[model samples]
Target: MLNLTSPILSDGLTTRSISCPNYSLRGFVNPSSKPRPLTAKPHQEIKTPHLSAVAANATEPLLFSSRAHERDQKDRRDQKDKLVVIMGATGSGKSRLSVDLANIFSGEIVNSDKLQFYNGLEITTNQMTVQERQGVPHHLLGEVEPEDGELTAAEFRSAAARAISGIVSRGNLPILAGGSNSFVHALLAERWDPETYPFNGRGSICSDLRYDCCFIWIDVAPPLLFEYHSRRVDKMLERGMFEELAELYDPKNDPGESWTRIGLWKSIGVPEFDRYFRKYPPQKTREAANRDDWDAARKSAYDRAVREVKENTFLLAMKQIEKIQKLRSAGWDIRRVDAAAWFRSALSSPDGDGGSGGRRCKEIWEREILEPCVERVRDEVFCLGEKQMTATYY
Candidate 1:
């Protein structure tokens, strides 16, 4: 409001002037505004970028998604593609636990055990029955063609990637469960031993697919696992294990144990029983009911074969444990679910009927193994993620 007297001093400045454009330095002020002279203190306009409301208020790690709906949808899709691997040595109850996880999580089981992938000899392969699955959808089981030969690890990765993508598209979890370490590893890791697989290591042997994987290792001590293998062999015999072995490795027909020389045909039960087949020669021994000495010798050979199978299974289990630990070292997310205490509790507890003990074991499993796993998947994989990880078994 510098209503200065006109022409007081043409060059004299007023104390201050604002909104009084009727005067200037020379006469009142020019009717238009002009720049004020600079001073020692500077005036600056401060501005800060806007932050997301959720992020600004959050106390924990924030999971960020795009502002656009389409980007949100893509984020959701990526989250859904998370892969769950249930892995362990032979007779570690991987299949059983996998079924439990899948059934609880609305997941579909993908067979990773190479033997279970074969269509023939469901008995020898130790395939789980529909009842055993308890209504969970399973994939890749009994899908392999015998004539296709052993599927190379690379081919398995391709197939698994496709299956996982398809499952995620349908809004279901893909649960890969079995003992096929290299095959499973191929899908998750960039590098693997190509020599072990059917394909030669050409170039990088890399699969272009990747997934956020949760690897669950169903673990048991070696001695306990060997006992399971022995008992499983005996049960297999009861369920026509030798018959499948006979068909797969008949000494008279194939003669040279050619199956033993092949790749996956060298699976656990295959090699151990090869010698037994040669010695007893299933074809000759099957009709030897009239000879006591021959049957007795065959019985001796059967025990020996079972013992060898158990021993080899123990060795294989050790290798599997070693491999699993190695994979962990290579940054694979591995969590071990110990079954020893649970088995002991379930089998030897009071009520002896085992029903209550089995139920208790299930409870322990839910509390210890399943819940923590779901939390890990939520925190690590999803961030209270789009998939809405829920308690399945409980």
Candidate 2:
């Protein structure tokens, strides 16, 4: 009799004999052309059970059943769709955090900032500078034209899904970062719709319409935001924001001919022009090119530009912050950073302005933006489990 518990071998002979050590048992041996184990040491030829045979019968009810296999497949399917989403108020250092996290996680940063989507308004919109990208790969930035006219959050999410699929295909993590909170969540929580085609023959398997990732929200308090806004404008002026704006605004030309100014005031033309002009005053033509007058006029324009940019930025920041709060309360995973703290710190750091003051600015970012962002990304890694997690999770 075959022992079902014993390992299956190619030979039919059982390893355990029926005869006991104390009691001898006699059995009739069949005489056939094939030799028995007792005769000529079983006339051997090297042989083994075929692995293909075992595999072929693996799904049979005799050993394992297809139901268990199907269950495992379903479990894998569930895990495959899991995704992470990042959201926050703009200028709260979401981009900086995302870029850093992308480095550690070996993931690509997917642009969720609506302003970043446009191509022409690169400097005005403050899209990532080429040097700032540090040779790191990115997706979805500068793909849309300014003329596209108000690309919705829904549309951005759709583009995101396609980007995600391609990233997944390459076995890389997709770091969804930007200020478009609603759009990011919509992709993670929504079901796939047949009509929505996000990939357009790209490697992505899903439309940008899907949302299926963890959500990370960056934020700052209103008071801190106001301070940060003012300082950021100051930094921008130092970076020649006034010069850039002046080049765009031609007081003498028709409005249609100029580059559209981005951000709060929208443009630098007409009726409500005081809103911007007060901060970015135009220069008066000098009777002659007097160096002192020209220097003074330029300085005034820079100062005014700083003030205008700050005021408008504060208003916009407040509105964005309100949205962030609502999203957080609604059960989204939101991580907030004190941008004012960061701005203050930046004001003091060597990279910021220059020495003792630079240290203060750097410290503020450490307390507010950098530390919080690092913690948020770490939490994501913990959720995925450090053993199975890759750099992408962080």
On lDDT, the leading prediction is 1
| Candidate 2: regions farther than 4 A off | 1-72, 80-84, 189-212, 250-306, 337-343, 350-372, 381-394
lDDT of 2 by residue, 1-394 (tens): 1111112233221112221111100111112334222212222454666977777777754445699788866654544333445666657676666676666545577787666665644555667887788666777787654444555544554566666655655544567777654455445543433344322332222223233345566665666667655666566555655455544444554335433343222532221333344444545322322436556765575456456656766776666666666656555555554465555555446544322454455456556665555555545532322332222222
Q: Which portions of model 1 miss their true places by more than 4 Å?
A: 1-80, 190-209, 252-260, 288-295, 346-368, 378-392
Worst 10 residues of 2 by lDDT: 20-29
CA lDDT, every prediction? 0.61, 0.51
Query: Which number leads on TM-score?
Result: 1
lDDT of 2: 0.51
Which 10-residue window of candidate 1 scores lowest in summed lDDT? Answer: 19-28
TM-score, structure 2 vs. true: 0.62
